[model samples]
Target: MNAPLTATGVRFADTALAQFLCTNRYTSLDELRQTATAAPRRFWHEVVTALGIQWAKPWTEILDLADGPMWPRWFVGARIDLYDNLVGRVAREDPNRPALRWEADDGATRTHTYAELDQEARRLAAGLAGLGVQAGDRVALYLPMCPEAVVTMLATTRLGAIVVSLFSGYGPDSVASRLQDAGVSLLICADSFQRRGKSVPMLDDARAAVARCPTVRNLLVVARGESPAATPPDGSHWHTVDYQQLIAHVPVTQGPAIHPADTPLMLIYTSGTTGKPKGVLHTHTGFPIKAAQDQLMAFDLKPRDTLMWVTDMGWMMGPWLVFGGLLRGATLVLFEGTPDHPGPDRLWDLVRRHDVTHLGLSPTLVRLLMAAGPAALPDALPDTLRVFGSTGEPWNDGPWHWLYDTVGQGRRPIINYSGGTEIGGGILACFPGLPQKPCAFAGPIPGIAADVTTADGQPANGEVGELVIRAPWPGMAAGFWQDDARYIDSYWSRLPGVWVHGDWAQVDGDGHWYIHGRSDDTLKIAGKRVGPAEYESALVGHPLVTEAVAVGVPDPVKGETAVCFVTVADARRLAARPWPEWERELAEHVGTQLGKPLRPARVHLTRSLPKTRNGKILRRLVRSAYLGQAAGDTTSLESPDALDHIRQCRPAGA
Candidate 1:
């Protein structure tokens, strides 16, 4: 038996983690690891039983990982479909109970009940079947966050088809890469989407993708903004029937049963920089369990809690929000508009209206809101709000504290969940029982055995190292879509036996985890290493600066020197105040924020930085343009000319 773990006097909210910590159910972290490692089948068996998963067929055996490292069979005898678990198994007492609430950018709102969603999904399943979609067929979904998108996801799951999600804003190249890589046969998208009072042509991008990739057999386009100016000459069709109308045509016979643990629920593509994006395959049982675990343990989500996560269907958070909320029988609030669009109070209004208990947002979004100035935000959160969740990137202490003190009144804990689509859910998350430290992750989840280790494969506590999962969990992805070799090479090659996640991290003496940044993005200058995000985090802490980006440029003595780009809220005001004094004050701000060694060699003020529609700063493009290198893949950029202005602001000689 593993030894017991002490709580160490950390308490924030009333969550399952608090219950686990107080009850001493499992004892120590080692004990939890032992359950996952010692007898993996038995451990998962217990978890599945606890989740009350409705398996159509019983499993004769649990897990068989001994045969090979990659081919681990979970729930060997069960045969069940994911739609059955997601839709059919919900409580029948309240058939009209709301499942999803979608708000469009143009002030259109729609609500779907569990029964409605299930029926619509079945209708779409029948429609897909008519289109020759089979059990193992691949279906590509490039639609926005609407009823059709949710129905398509559920419909594909219902039919045992692999649903590959593509971002609605992805250009032809990215969409083609994902479609070709996944061998997707059918595509679903809308004519266009409204963003910031502009109609963005999402269907045009999809058509362009299909033109490049001939494997796509059919295109199903939904009308959103206006009819497209053009269409494919071949097999293109318009989506006319409402999701409910389509589902009413199909018979609601309980589909063929599948193994609870063996069925693939969803395939979320990873965000790649260099090579082709890898499709991370997640199973029905393991994936949903992890989502539920995180929702309950990290956020303390319950049925009475209404949760909202600002994300699109293409992102991992979209699926995480869906399954986690449904598995816990919680309400999900979805907004289709940009968080800051129409006004900065849009998000705040949603929280107020819905009485959302848990709110999940990106660190970038929080930082952007902070950039809008403190006066732009409400002084406090709604009384119903209990916790805030942060993901995607590591957070700076400034935004973290601002969210905690101003919005939460220092009572709510920010459940920082750090994991990829490949892991289905979080590997490291904040527990409510753990002391709410500003900008620090709580610890590895109870069932997840994770550690921070140096390059030499040695554990490093209170020091920087790579974050790796020491053992496997039920939620681990099967592999990249048809790219098993690449999966093995990309993740397993870094460390012989361990799962390398490629995130730099440090664990404090109290076991608080802090993610530095991506290991691949680490910068080396003058024989000293630093993360670009580290500098950006420091610069954003300044009162005058709203946002910042750091890039490395070649230098004679330093090999590479740091070039910082900052966007101040009112730069003209600062300049009008004083001349050299203001410059010194701003530079001194960076110095005081980050200390000298990590300070930028040069700082340039820019009106705006190039970013994707989702607000991801294009650091590599900024770096490449600064270094006079070709900026590859600029098609997905929100504004192509945004870089032109950034370039003009560069120092004369640089």
Candidate 2:
């Protein structure tokens, strides 16, 4: 049996995870993993039924692996509709229950009950149908975190039309590329949204992108009490449809369409280190089941709990929040504002005011918050706060502990969840029912048969190795849309049947799981391999280093050496010191934490780090930008201009 890293200091004794496992006759999480994986079909049936995901027809088989593990289909003969299960069912059961709550940067708020959301979704679905969107047609969504974003998502999927999420910050080219690639027939976007008390005209980019993509028939605009940014060009073929007009003109005569459980419900694109971005297809049963199950296991999310994860629709967590929170009949707090907009206390104030029970944040955000210190936040969390969810990147011990001590108040467990647009929810998670640790996942939550493999494909015991999944779970992506071969090469081709999750992971002596960094970002200095996170963690461990990103640079003797870029917590304090002296001290710090051999060769101070919309550090892009090489697939980057700062960090005569 896997031992706990610490004593069973479970914050919640009767956690949803423990109750579900015990009720199913399992003794512990490990036992559940072993037994459920042994009977995968039966386990899925029980899980789906327990999660309240109803089916129109019973499935003859839970899974079919005849097509191989890379393309396993789920719920072979069952018929299900995500909207009906997520909204219709809940609205009927408790119509007045709050489905979603929205708060803007300006302190404006809006609430939607299950009944209201259900009707809005149905009405939007009818509007899309009236506008000529058919089942299986792709509809792109490029709106901010608002009520319409969620409604449109449900509406599109309700009509069996696959909803494609685009990052709200994407420029014209990036937006046009995904739209053209998906053959999108319609796009829903906001005219503008407030961030830091400033209006960002999204319709400008949406119009610019749609003009380039001939396949888009209509550009639907969600008026955010802001006027349209610009008039359409004279020759633009797509019509601009007001969001309210589209919904108001149509009356829903029917409910959601029943689809095969394995039918494509959503398409999410994942940009890699190289090559074109791959679109991951998710089924009605696949993503939602894994999302809800993981939420229950990891966060102990309940019907009364309110969840708020800082994410955009472009990322997986956005859809996960919509489906998982609503599928379980939980309230959602949608904050469409920057964390430090009005003040550093903006996030904490949102939590306190919204009564958010479960709040999710990224390690990057926590580091930023630490700069302002605890005094910038509330004295204590609201009484409603219970669970803390964290993802997007691996946490360093410093930020993780700060989040635990300051924000979590030493009571909440910072559930470090790790997964992607492809995996649906999480492969590893920190269960609230298990022992707590600073920066470690308890293990695979449930359904995920996670394992670590050595360089030779042998089992890795208490050693750093490739994180691989031994068995296919229901949430696995159906395939990369229109690119089956690329999908195979991405995950399955490397280890045959085993799914090679790109991150390097390890199991420590006490059975704690930790992610080092992406496998592609690992540096081999003199044939000794180490991930960038090690170097980054060492730098950020210092109180002055608010953020850091490390990448490999070519070396004459060592083959590869680490180059770390960091943002300072105190600009004035850093400016007081000479660059050479500070660089020496930082390098020595890393040497002290790791070893002399693994110390970073150089440290450069930067204003900011390049990150994705969901706050994941773009290590590959950083390396490319610094090395003056071609940066590949930068569509997912939240701030492309940050690359210029890294490029300027390049030293002369180096």
Candidate 3:
């Protein structure tokens, strides 16, 4: 077995975690973790008070576990509003502090102070009230990541209304499905926004979506660029208003609406593995507190830090960034274009120019940058960088090392966080103070009772198993919107008393945690099981390979066999050698590294893999294409054409 990486004395001494441990009287990370897990209620209470969380009315109890671990209610009997804690209090305390900074593809930049952001949110809230949108009403935001999007979200939540965040990239059908399901009463969107140096029409899709959503009574549009004015088409029943004009005369001194702790804050839909997207509902106390807690403990976010995560408004990370950064008093940076546009170093440029202290991105993006070669990277690491954050997908060693060495310059820690929209924040994350190995988690976040367990419920170590939560945390979704049964079946059905998160995980002897892959994506070959990531990591470790996806295909002799789909770093190198010889060598390399039984039965070359907008490879879709089966739920696929490449390159007859 390989030895675990150990942090140097200087790195450990300078971390925020070191400060926290000293202040809290904890000797080590292990001591802190044990204390946090021993009594979660007390830990959370301390955390909330330490963070100075504001509430309309204090809770009589910290937690209500009477309903069982799966349905634990947190912050019981408390009355609060998200905007009060996130925007109102911050604005009052530091009115001139930088709250938001946005940069466009064309080099246009905008910054908003805390006071300015609060006033804008109040104006939008007043306008929403004028349109008869009251408490509990669902308002869909179909705009990109801009200042207006943040304003609209805060405004809606301030009025105790639920905001349905629609992905800006979604077509009319996708937008309509979510809007109709949520029974949205109003929609706020942008006329157009620049993507890859081109004007993309968003309001046009919003208009088309409204035509199909009979529940929407108003359509408000923001003019994002100098594109043609957006107007409601002929014979539309809904009233159309310019966003600026609608909020122009609204007062900016109104107070936020008070609601109980469990008041629905937002209806964020998950990209479904099957059927329509499930609405993952969150409340004022549930999502915001959890997001802030994670930011504070895991990332050690500070008011002076500028935190930026590359994501769209439609993804969970979008709201995560807004609520988490603000609650922690950090300046949030928003970018409205591709990271690699204009040049491969555009992301690095943004980091340098914005003085981003904590920069987050997907491993897929790092792979793209790696393919561009080291020359594409900045000559030096950004001077202000304090931490590197990553999520969205599991990391491969190649890109992980590139990000660690080339980007972070071996001076900062890479905080690997993993969770889903349903969990609100991370279940497992690496702290800056801990020693980290490539692709390993420090442990479960404090206050989250997470473990890796076998099928029969025994704890498993040194072997991959299901990632389960033994106790409910504040961020657990309040069941799927209008579908309680489906929510129960999806998460709780797999384990008796635990929340079975659909991922394979393992814990090493030294206490380091590792997420293998999605449990559903596990491959069973000759009665032996393996996560797809195990094969992918092996294949990507090869010199010439850039990306790879391993899938289990039906086999007659063995129950299943591995089929590998790969893309190369240099296509010219492939043409220099015989294709058959190269494929054989790659398969033998896997056999040599992982044993003969784990070797891929066939290797197929491809140009790209099917991935989501967030860059998570769709292994199920790849398997479907190989088996000539219907690809279920390609709605989240970013490159649908990548499936055609998989089908074209599939090996003939098993």
Candidate 4:
């Protein structure tokens, strides 16, 4: 076993995790992970107490594992509500403290203190109840990242209704599908939002979607940008209610309902391998506790810290930030537009202006910012910055080091986090007090029983295999909404009782974990298995290449061959050089970095690759487009035109 590389050489003494260890008398990380994994009930009880999570009634039992690990229920016989823990308790203790800070694309900023936010949520909750929204009714929120979005989420949960948070960037068809699937009764949205300095209409898309969703009875709109005065539809059965008008007549104080701990709280939908989106159900005690624990244990969030993640409300991070930050009494910073809009340094400028303490971003965003050169970066790192966080996809060394050395200034740690919507928070994360490698996680999160396993389901160390969870946590969704069979088949069918997360993972000899890539994207060449991230990393290591995506294509002899699509730093200079020489050189470079057998069959050059709004490269869409097949369910794609570019640049006979 090689010694773990200490790339950053940074550690904190007064972090939340450090305090937890000192108070709990745990000597090391292994002790904490092992104890937490072995005794889930005691760990969660301590966590709830440490976080000061308010409950209407205490549970008699911490966990009921009688249903098996896949369906373990936590907090039996307890009554609680998410709003009570998130807003009620905090607003009572510190009414003047800031709870949320919001900024629009044009630099318009707004601040909401705990008192003001609680008042708004109460008024909105009363107004929603007046509109016939009852407990168990589903309300769809398609608004942009703003104070109203946060208010609506809290108010819905307070009223014991389920929140169906939709992405603001989704089109009419995509919105319609989710609304229909959830049987949503009311929709809250913005009239327009600014993106890249342009007013993007949101209500029109909502109206088009509502025309197909018969369950929606009311449409509440918040006016923004230069949207035309919203007029109630003349002939439609449903009514349009102005957001401000509805809340005007309601009282500013309303108590939240105390439901059982397992009461359904929200439904977050994530796409499956078959391209169909599944609604993942979370409960009062499920998602919020898991998210708060991650912030407390991994990021070491403090009350004085101001955290921001460049994300939209449609993504999991949206609700995650809302509950995680507020529950821990940390101020949340929300931005409602593109991170690099108007200029490449826009995000850096925000960090400086807001004095952001923890800045979270995607590696793809880092690569985009890097393309602007050093001049586009701030002259110095913000003094308030303490932690840099990343998620969404696996990172390559080029961007990871650039973030660690340049953005963090060699003093802060990039808390690499990886998990899915179904997992609630993070399955693996780098702890604040631990020494970190370039892109490696220190270990599995304290409470998660995570491991890498071989094809035969045996635990594998220092080798690549499927990542699986052996124990159930509070965060596992209460079965995919309305589809218990699909939920079991998706995660448990592969391995009898374990949750088979479809990602290729490896644990180094030093016990640090690294995610290779998605297991479904694995390629078999000459009977040897490899992840596309390995090849893509080697290709991006080239000085000229900025980014690359590798896909497996049919080959007569090797069963399958590697084909790469890459974008370069300078397209004009490369075009002027000899094409055949460049292709051969790039292919040979990959072969040298990896083995010869894994060499790409062909290296295709393209202007861009299709990606999601969150900056995840769509390798499946790329392969589909290259093979001239239907690119399934591209509703999540940010730039569908990038697919057209790839198809246009297809090899002569590909």
Candidate 5:
């Protein structure tokens, strides 16, 4: 049995969930756990009913997977358009109700109601049709997190056109690759965005990429930031638009709503072994359900809650945050600049101002914030704050505890969620009603058949193994976009029928789950396998240390030896503090947190670590550099310079 969870940490205001608690009151954590375990299908069905999903054509079957693998249908015959469901229905109820609240790093904010969003979506959809974009035609959206991007997505989906959301930070090559793969008909981008205190020329890159994409015919440019010094050549032909121009011309007409349950809504491309990107196709029912379910359970989402998760359109979390927040009728706050750019307290300031109920972040970002000190965080938040969710990379107990103590008052839960772009939502998540354990996931969500198995496919306890989902669920991506064979080979080939996600996991005797690290980064040192997260977790416990990355480099004797890269609070001061004085203390700290055998062979101090736009450490780049291999994809790196600094460092014991 799991540890008894007590409801003694955080309390809620007279909020949306407070009434739910009163009507169907749960006194203890055990009661909440029992409610979920006792009737999971009933819980989900209730969620569906509560969300009030419009059924234009009634569903013949809510869910059907009986035939075999590769075929799954949800809300079988429901004919409601996803865009219509999100915007139309909501607007019909209260057109003036705020649907999107956008805030930039400059403190500029805009609020758009459901009617405004619907009208903008209609105009955007009409503009695309005028540009000759047809159903199933891919439209590449390379814009920042604005109302335009959101409306563009819904408009495209409404027309049955697959929307490919490209990260605004993506360069020409990255943009060209996705555009070519998708055979896009239209390209949407902004003039530029403010990044690192400077205006970036987003349109310049989009123009360059469009030149390479033969299928791209029209360019819809949102005039934002500074006016570009040089516009696209006349022959290239650009249709200029501002916040109003795009929506002003077109009439509001609900487009055709397609329903297949298997029909692809979005094509999200992820990196593959061959260095080619594989598009992960997500359908309406599967994607929406997973997003709604995960957010509901993982963060204890309620209608009155306000959430802010830092992410870009390119990353999966971008969509995850959107669907998750909206599905639960929660308020979503978006920031258009770096989380710590110009200052460290940017995120926390937003949190305090918005009265955010749940804040989702990654460990790498937490480590960066820790380096800035807790002074970077705001002192108080809404007394209603209940959950803090994290993902992207493995977390340390230090940040885990800090999240609870500082932000959550030691009572709120730090949900360590793990999943991939293809999974749509987290496969493993910690529920608010579960016992709060530092750096440990509560368990696999009920209805999800999850386990950590050895290489031979046998289950193990307290031993790190491959995390796999044994059963097909509603949210599994249909397949790689237009690459069926690669999709089959990537996920299904490893273990026939079982979804073998490339993650390392462990389970305690009491059934708590823990993500070790990515399976690819699992280090084999002197015949013993160790997860980098284990050592990173240990290093985080040090008072002066902020963040660390453990990479396995090829060694003549050990096959692979551990090399740790550290970013500390007083980076230069710590380096000059004399290892003779503090080395023993630091070594002892590691020994206490992790076993002696798992200690890093060498520790190299650095000022900063490379991170992705979504705040994941670029461990692959670190490992590739140590192994003298190519840095496969630097497109996602938040700081490309960190890899160069790592490459210039001397080898261990040199």
Candidate 6:
């Protein structure tokens, strides 16, 4: 068992969660969780009141469960708007304080104060309203991590329209499919953005998408940097407008459009690893409130701190950072470049320049940095960093310890956060005020009511089981957009009166929880079920291997055998000898570590594995591509050619 990380100088008394507990007459988080889970209505009421949630009108009821456990209405009959709470409230309190800090790949920098952002959002709101955008209309924002992306999101929400944000890396087909599904009336995009020193023509993709999406009538384009200003396609049915010119107009929005708390605010799609991406609908109150509560109560984030997560808008974490950071009155950082671009020192430079306090990264990114920049990385993290936040995927102890030892110097803790788009923020998260293990979650965030159960729906106390929630939280997706039956079948139908999140989870005797991997990706060999993370952890433990992905393939004798693909950090290891010898050695090493019963069937050396823009390995795609099966929904991949890399991998004796 790993020892919990000791908090040296951090005090629980100074945290916002401490005040929240004291206000509710609770002495500790455990007490609060017990009371909150038993009486969710009272807990939510007290929490909202204690936090001084910016409500235009007080709520009549905290929760209405008449709709059923799968669909719980929160803050019923209350008027609240995200624009008022996230930007306007902060601008009123401290207008000159920085709300957002942005830096592009080419060293372009911009900082927006709370007041400035408020005005810009209002200006664009008026521009959109003049173009016949009305409340409840859907507006799709296909933009990169630029200032306009932030402005357009706020502006659309200010007018009470639902914001559908697409990941910037998507192609025209991905864009058009979502546009038609949402029946979006307006599409906002950038002319171009930089990635790996190459100009990505976002406008070309947007135009092609709009041409295919008949529901779209107006195209709003932000001419990025000094790139040649793009012209609107001639003889198009939709109107084309300039984004900066829209912001230059007179500010016409007086205040937020009044709407009930349950009004739909945004529609975000899941990263489609399973199949087609499912649309998750979030209300104005549900997602934002849950995000702020999770960030504040778990990490003790303060307004004085700056937070950054290396992610793109297409993933859930992008909006999670924006809403959670801005609502807490913290400086939000946005980066538009690759971490290894220009120099491996880019992320470190951002940290020192911004004095960032909370930095979020994926375990995959940590492995990449460790392999790519052993020499370029600093001996210690910047002094300004108070916490290392991580999510998107599970952690193996090798990379986790390296980050904790090398970058953090054993002082700071890597707060392992685990959740997904459907959960809003986190199901299980580590608290900075408490002790922590290498990759164990401190437990369920207070009031989340998470549990573990076997596939047969039996209670699992000390063993791995399906991660589930007994009660609904504010952050859960209201429902799948236009597919309520699919939403029920996805989560609720799996178990009675429970939301079964599709991840293998375990809680040890010490009460620390750990995610194994996706249950869908779990491998069953000789009738022994094992999570891919186990084999993956052992494979990456090899010195030459930097990253790895494990998948189950058919075997006539054994039920299913594990086929592992790995990327080597040192090219010299490959050129030095035949790869088959080393492959057998590495496969035997996994057997030695995890036992022969779980040893992989084959270890294939691949140049690169397919991944999402957020750096999560898409195991489904890798497995399909290896079997020469159709790779479904390759649009979310960072590089389409990554699939071909898997196909081309021909390890000897396979």
Worst 10 residues of 4 by lDDT: 1-10
- The local lDDT score (0 to 100) that residue 450 gets in candidate 2 is 90
- Against the unseen true structure, what C-alpha lDDT does each candidate score? 0.73, 0.85, 0.85, 0.86, 0.74, 0.86
Number of the candidate with higher TM-score, 1 or 5: 5
**Model 5 backbone overlap count:** 1
* TM-score of decoy 5: 0.91
Alpha carbon RMSD to native, model 3: 1.8
* Candidate number with the higher lDDT (1 or 2): 2
Which digits, one per residue and each the tens of the lDDT, describe model 5 over residues 435-542?
Answer: 646777877764466778888788766788999877666678888878888877777778766778888998887667888888888899767888888888788777
User: Model 2: residues >4 Å from true position, as ranges?
Assistant: 1-12, 225-231
TM-score of each: 0.90, 0.97, 0.97, 0.97, 0.91, 0.97
Q: Which window of 10 residues has the lowest lDDT sum in candidate 3?
A: 1-10
lDDT (Cα, tens digit) per residue for candidate 3, span 1-654: 434454332266665556667877888877777788787777778777766788888999988989877677888899886787788888888899999899998778999999899989999999999999999999999888899999988998888999998888888888999999999999998988888899888887888899999899999888866754556777887988888887888877565667899888898888766678999999888888888888877887877689999988888999999988888888999999888888998998999888899898888888888888865688776668888899977888878878887666676778899999999989999887667878888898887889998987888857889999888888889889899889889999978878999999999887888898899899998677898988888888898888899999898899899999999878999977888888999999898878998899988999999987667888989999999988876766777799999999766782
Worst 10 residues of 1 by lDDT: 1-10
For residue 271, model 2's alpha carbon misses the true position, in angstroms, by 1.2
TM-score-wise, the better of 1 and 6 is 6
Error of 2 at 155 (Å): 0.7
Displacement of residue 227 (Cα, Å) in model 1 is 5.3
lDDT of 6 at 59: 83
lDDT of 2 at 92: 86
TM-score, predicted candidate 3 vs. hidden true structure: 0.97
lDDT of 2 by residue, 209-250 (tens): 998899999889888764543547788888888888788888
Q: Which TM-score value belongs to model 1?
A: 0.90
Model 1 clash pairs? 10-433, 10-435, 78-259, 79-258, 79-259, 80-258, 80-259
Worst 10 residues of 2 by lDDT: 1-10
